[model samples]
Target: MKGVSLAPGDYIHFKSQVPLHKIPIGTKQWRYYDFGPKVVSPLICLPGIAGTADIYYKQIMSLSMKGYRVISVDIPQVWNHQEWIQSFEKFLDVINVHHIHLYGTSLGGFLAQLFAQHRPRRVKSLILSNAFLETRSFAAAMPWAPIVGWSPSFLLKRYVLTGIRDGPHEPFIADSVDFVVSQVETLSRDDLASRLTLTVDTATVEPLLLSDSFITIMDTNNYSAIPQQLKDQLSERYPGARRAYLKTGGDFPFLSRPDEVNLHLQLHLRQVGVEARPDLVQSIPKGGTGGSPSKESDKKKDPDDQPKDNGGNPESTSEESQLPPSSEIHSLDDQLLSDARICSMGHEDAIILMQSQYTVVNRILQSACELFIFSLLPIYVESSYVTSNNVWKFRQLM
Candidate 1:
């Protein structure tokens, strides 16, 4: 809730930068940041529980630099999944965005899936990062429902922060976490409780079956708030989803690892035939353009002249175009591995690795504190005389 201050020159720069827009949806106003060109299929960013549209500043600026329209939203205070989806659809309609490429992190990722399932035709692609299918495990781990609605706002904010503060020691991650915590502090008890309810509420989600829409799943290598089991479940649910791993950026990689995230995004966009902005054409390095056909003239070739796959999409005739040139794939693979090492080690090793990093030690400690606090919650609830009837009453109120 802290306002960004700008000097005279800074004010000019800030205004030239992405400007925030407020759209009225029914009685409530939805705030958002819109960037990049209006022509392309816009990359709509949806933030997690502790996020606002501003948190995606790095991604918006970076992706826009590469010629993609990007928009990030401050989700309205709507708790019901179906209602939220309906409101979101109306929001998009108001903005005149017929189709969008979605980039959702954590809670936002879950909502993105719901939106896509509910309105599949409007989605061009999906990028789900550090998100899961359901909240059963999370709800079981932290049984704060009885107290969440009545607890002091700071306590609730602290609890939320402890759970998600895990990230590398980078300044960007630290600053982002700090900003999120600040925003969290501004939430009223009702707002916090509503968000918590939304987090744990169960809903059935079917597999998103949009063939034309590219699907990519991104997660951090070293640390993830999302469980491995949930990640596996997502893969099982979306079989065609291309799995991309980030080496170091932890929960909020878009802020921490913009370059890498942007690369994958650019490649995916090219694969689906979204054109880059003309001004940013030279930003992509020479020799690798995600194997997209370079010449616009090539797109007009005769059907007979074009090679066809079994599925009938155009197939590159030459070996160089068949797949990303081996060199490019190798380079990208090496970068991915270097940036995000997959977690294949034991729990002890993982803990040691996490603790050894001075930058991330505080984050690990915060998570530990969260778990410790969670352990004490049941006792606190018992002492506070919170009963099943009280829980039922609270649920009804919600």
Candidate 2:
């Protein structure tokens, strides 16, 4: 796909009442392509750090093929955070879409979460792949490089490339790096400075990176580095919400594993009852859980351990139900805790623990009790014994 280049002030606040034909987004009118399918939902794709709206061309096309109304924006070099929000609002207004399913990557994922947090009603569902939920890691990972260029391409592909090189989109990063390195050979210092400014201006968090942003980054990193507790936090934050883990790493999974990303998106949209193209089925990967536990969960168990329900399921064991006996829980629990790296006091401890009478209800209750111990010991409890909301909810169910 050819790139779409726009000057700094080229298309800000531009409006087109009718969907413009396959025109350039910046050359003249604000272009909007009509892939001409009765899309199940309108989608907005945002780029990551130093990414142009054009970088997602393959994604936009792939999604369009699946009957989606897709909009890929040309992010202004330096945009006011509020104005960007308004730009999204205006896009929805022009497109006459009340709600949208958003798929954001990296910085775009960060921004998408912010948008959903602030405007929950407008977001139908969100899929954030290889994105930073916080900025601390980003700051820690990439200390400031001198602003030596004007175009975003040079610095993004050169200086920032290292941070995302091992990311999900290794192929894209490789090609991008080659292109930028070649472009850098001939770029003047002033041009480099301009590109640095463009990159920084586009990627910088509005109103400065706040403590919340840092917390999100920390939590997201924790999600990978410490899977068990992070999954617990996510479950707490979005109760009854559906979530999944994609096998790829870094950011930009959409670019690296477009079909996988697309499959996840399709599944999520379906779960929410949103309209989507059925052709998405072919894009799904085999042997992957549609939305079930990944094998990472299976490896984290104590071998001799008894099953701990942890209030997850409560199916009774009986001839009619044919539910597996106590052995099943012990086996599954091991998988659930594998990535957690938190031991269940070892196999002997699990064996001793499992010797007692077992029932689905009892297993769930015991699991809740264990989680309560881990979660509420530090918090103040003036009037009640439990301080954490998650524990309280579990107690209610128990």
Candidate 3:
């Protein structure tokens, strides 16, 4: 019943739109997805134990397109909280992003608070999702934390996956869960073990200098892997913090309920005084912010805009539905043809062009890539074209 849209299509769109970058700060290798204009202060997202940087592809796609700088990062295999703080500091320094708005989920939330507590100036604001204030209860439950690193991958995955509740979920929620399971499957033994170790490690987030007004506690109302008591304690800790509660976003609101989550994020960004890049603010296609496309992109509504119907609904294709109407596919084929011409002209070897993988590749090609993804990929999303695995095989075409 559920249509998986993010993979090979939207997901590959994300990959093409915002290329992944790995920055090695000494022993710690950080894998992250960064997008949007470089001028604005970036909103950095940290995922929980069962997730990876790719988990926030929705955030990257939705917000970055609208002019916000969003960076989604994976939790490296750091053993402890103190090391995490240090490694994270070095990561920021390497990237040269002086100030950031930290958005963390579960363990990532706890880590965000922990980092803000230690390095107050670097963090402009904090958004904690399904986060806890302390690890005492977690440590108590995981009595075998000391031996976590030695645990086998299956055992570690079992332990980490226990946090996500199992049930007959709605199609979207089921798709979200399926996506998460796929991400968890990508984790290395050390990655899973270290994340579990951090969850159980005895650490508490102390009070911070940042105002509660600058913090947004975004949590799901339904159910969370983190206990309700912890969520309550966190709310109590920062009584002045803004509350952005979702009506029904299970553990991963940013995944299962993206529009709501993105809405909250944009509001929080505004509250925190972070401005969208002015140059990009109006150029957003489809849902335009008063900016018109240039001469080249004349007919194209922002190339990144999802393929939508005349009713303004995202054109969705369930397993039960037929291929999208020919007009739409024809539109996509034309843009992809344009994209091919652009890529070929930009680089002598088209293969090298795709391989170069610059984040921006400048505005002209950025729009071209966006056109390439939205034009070609949505057809794949709206109809079952191929699995995400096949997307990697797309490289073999070159």
Candidate 4:
């Protein structure tokens, strides 16, 4: 077959614009797209079954332009979650990422949750789209799973295409479906079998115990692949998670409704303190020029009328100058230190109290330091100081 040519509006075009890179993971070579600045924490996007990292080209382009470092990968042919997690960890290490904000769709979402469960501290936030905790009615179809492995590539591609042909008729969605079908055609039988095994093998794991991480679950109300019961269960599992529902986008909301999906995504990212650049944001039309508010009251006011640094009252600036300087404001740090001093008998006592807290913090930090320390003597010395020494002795030394 000749190469498929994608239109400029197609997501595949964006995917092609970004160069792909290969990273060696043991005996296998994994293909990935790593774009955006290196300084920011990466937004690692994992695509659903039948999706390569290229499926999220829209997200990569949109988010990366907004100052985020986005990375997406082709799932290495690993059947079990443990192997997938281990290989992914090694891949992150090779790329020098200690922590990341994870975004995944469908099967990829399952993997993302597993990865987060395995390394909760390493995940900054999680975005799950059209994903479920386990296989539902799909497992019943697994009796024919062996057939998928033995079927000709053309037949497999046709089955996948036929299944998703009922999705929204948007040009981008159609393009994406074709692109995904093409990707499926290139997959080896072993790869297809492993992916199928992954789906069936997936089961309900314990709810993540992540208090510090932000979790967003995005799905379309019309999604049929994952039942409503599963979605409710997911919500019950993550009570604190934010949920965004589109009225209609079927199984692949990201492709069918990129504008809405992007809006929800940007809002979620902003809530966690990551925002797109002003220039990049302004470049995209509000609501993608598709829908508009019908009421005159819904119209946005002129930019000039918006509140400025002076709080929309120029005279307030002069009044503000009469107020006390910010430096004079009493802060929690100052109050805490004052309390520490008051609780002590003298300067020595205050110093000792502060030093004790520092020592405790230092001891806690040694765990992270152990990552780099190779020598046995250094480890023994640090361990001995932490375990054998009394608090009184440490205070006296301080």
Candidate 5:
């Protein structure tokens, strides 16, 4: 699991592609987590915007237990929904999955609808949870998406604990927020902006707006407002198809109201002769493995854990400065400032003066450190990861 490999059951695991084999897919590589029985069964669980394969961890495990083959696709950064769905379709071919049970949430749900419409034969049944038929709502909110991405890392904690409300269908909203925040923390301001722009540019609206399709769009809305003409067309296209509108407040029905959503799905699957196994659904207890870190713990600092403090004032304490060692001073002055670059102040004095103004010098150094440190350590390790033992490594040398 640590690296990419194929197990006996044909499970493909790739942490990262090697230099020779890797092909960049926008900002992120396409990954697939395959699970369940070797024979035919529910074969895919696609997720939505800002979503990663990890989001469907529980679903993959649960469905695998139920003897269903499941593959959650990691979406690449794409400018349009058509391109996004096209890439997903190619991936499906690569995986060689002939038949699929399409399950998607939010944007993923929209993509699922598109996929089924394009290749109805390949899709056995379609399941969309807490999603919209059109992305106008998301496109309208595009400007704010960058703010969410660039906001301080701690914002996730506030949003999860109180800012975001839990719905009956999506119980994992809080956990999902934490995971997304972790991803956002790693993004650069420009990277996030570009991604948002791409999302808005690539959103697919026409296909979803179609009145005739065998797809079901699920959400808290009871579907009462859908135009009767469109509803009639839908019934005519897939006579057995039905719309399920579970009343859940949160956007993530999979997390907050998985039971309710699952129940509805089970009922529909039964109608189509597919059995439901509640026991096969995975349930993660609160504060269980990979749960959100406690607020108090996040703020607390351990004595052993200290970030590299690059602001020590050795020059401020004259006692700590070595004697003028004329030979050393002459050598330093020569290297410090070449004749063409000499400022109004003499090179030797300027050298001493810069060090003397430790306050300003340290401030400048700290700012540079904050900006460049992320490049060196892309993982965004917490302060806890830094320790006093290696503090010297991060110290700004004067």
Candidate 6:
């Protein structure tokens, strides 16, 4: 149970690939996961009240693999906003990162903005999701904010967990909530107390000197822990800020909707002049083309295994003439056909296509020619694990 993951094996894999770094700057302990290349500018991820550095594992895994530097850090123990900001600044100094792109959620978002406002030159861009412009409502709700430091750990956890809605949720959202609960279980009495104190500290972010173009306000269209009015107010405040809106990702979109969130983050980084060093990405050998898959599906057939076409027009099956099935498609063969237009049903189902002795993963509905767009798409997977993190991958039929 200790090594179990709510969302498959992401946690285990994350720990294996990225080492945890705990550096003490004065009395504050800086815990974080710094991944990807060190040369490029870093993107610092800060989480909300119930979050830790590990909460942004999805971001670290995806971006870091693509040669982007991502530092997902825990907010150092601090009583007030100034201390938090100063401690973060010193932590960055200790890390030797001169400038950064900040990504924050909830209370972390406020701290990101505050830091940006105070140290304008040090922050290149900001991406705030489900964050607040002010904590007035929270302070008002918890009249005993001053006593939070003295509150029991269980009480503090309850206060934090109550904010995360409990009940039936979509599969991904439910998994995300479960994962956050697991993270909360790891927090110490001081951790929860410090975050709760920040939440109810009644501080507001001042007008930032950074341009709106360098800011991206990401949030779900569906309900979240943050108030509607607060989100609206933040939007209104930054009229020129890039608005990356998702359909329904709840409170923790980074965990629930990592694909969309990572996509937005990449776009933000590109817009802010932080380029990804794709050359630094390492190649892992997977079965099929040049190697063997870790676990070959019983129904899978490699190009070498298939009979050669006489005319070389690529053999068209009967299923290729029609749209693929609408039900739950488990295998790649059952999911794909010769005609890409027919194979792509646009239901957001994963499809695998084997061609030219290589495997291609087709994730999104994409275009009529799935393989053609594979190179054009930024998040496209060239070749990946046949089964990664206990999740099936997508490959476009070339």
Where model 3 places Cα greater than 4 Å from the true spot, the runs are 1-8, 281-398
lDDT of 4 by residue, 170-260 (tens): 5645555555666676677666666766776636556776653399988877544666777777777787889888887766666656667
Worst 10 residues of 1 by lDDT: 317-326
Q: Candidate 6, which segments miss by more than 4 Å at Cα? A: 1-7, 283-398
CA lDDT scores, all candidates in order: 0.64, 0.41, 0.72, 0.61, 0.44, 0.71
Judge candidate 2 at residue 146 and give its lDDT.
36
Question: Higher lDDT: candidate 3 or 6?
Answer: 3
Candidate 2: where are CA atoms >4 Å away? 1-39, 136-157, 166-241, 277-398
List, residue by residue over 268-288, the lDDT tens digit for candidate 6: 999988876655444221111
**Cα RMSDs of all predictions?**
16.6, 28.2, 19.1, 26.5, 26.8, 23.5
lDDT by residue (289-386, candidate 2, tens digit) is 11111234334342113221111111111111111112221222342243123112234443344344334557899999999886775564632554
Prediction 4 TM-score vs. true: 0.63
Give the per-residue lDDT of model 1 (tens digit) for 1-398: 11121112212232343445665669656777655544456788898877777777666655655556677887777767888889898877655566788888888888998898999888878888988787777677776664555677777777777787554467656644555665666667666765676677767567776662488888888776678898878777777788889888867787667668878787888877777564533333322221112344234432123321111112222222111112221244554553333212224543445345644766889999999999999998896776776888999999
* lDDT tens digits by residue: candidate 3, 1-398: 12222242445444544455665669888877655655567899999998899999878766654567777889998999999999998877655566899999999999999999999988889999999999999989887888998999999988877778998887668878878887888899999989888988888888999999999999888888888999999999999999998889888888788778887898899988987653553432332211111233344342223221111112111111111112221232353343323323332343344434433355678798889888987788756656665776887886
Question: Which ranges in model 1 have alpha carbons more than 4 Å from their true place?
Answer: 1-16, 146-151, 166-172, 186-190, 279-398
Encode model 5's per-residue lDDT on 282-341: one tens digit a residue.
332211111111233334342113211111112121111110111221222343232113
After superposing candidate 5 on the true structure, give the runs of residues whose Cα lies further than 4 Å from its correct spot. 1-28, 140-176, 179-198, 202-216, 221-241, 245-249, 273-398
| Residue 361 in candidate 5, Cα distance off native in Å | 25
**Alpha-carbon deviation at 158 in model 4, angstroms:** 5.0
After TM-score superposition, what is the CA distance of residue 132 in candidate 3 from its true location, in Å?
0.6
Question: Which structure is stronger by TM-score: 2 or 5?
Answer: 5
TM-score of 2: 0.45
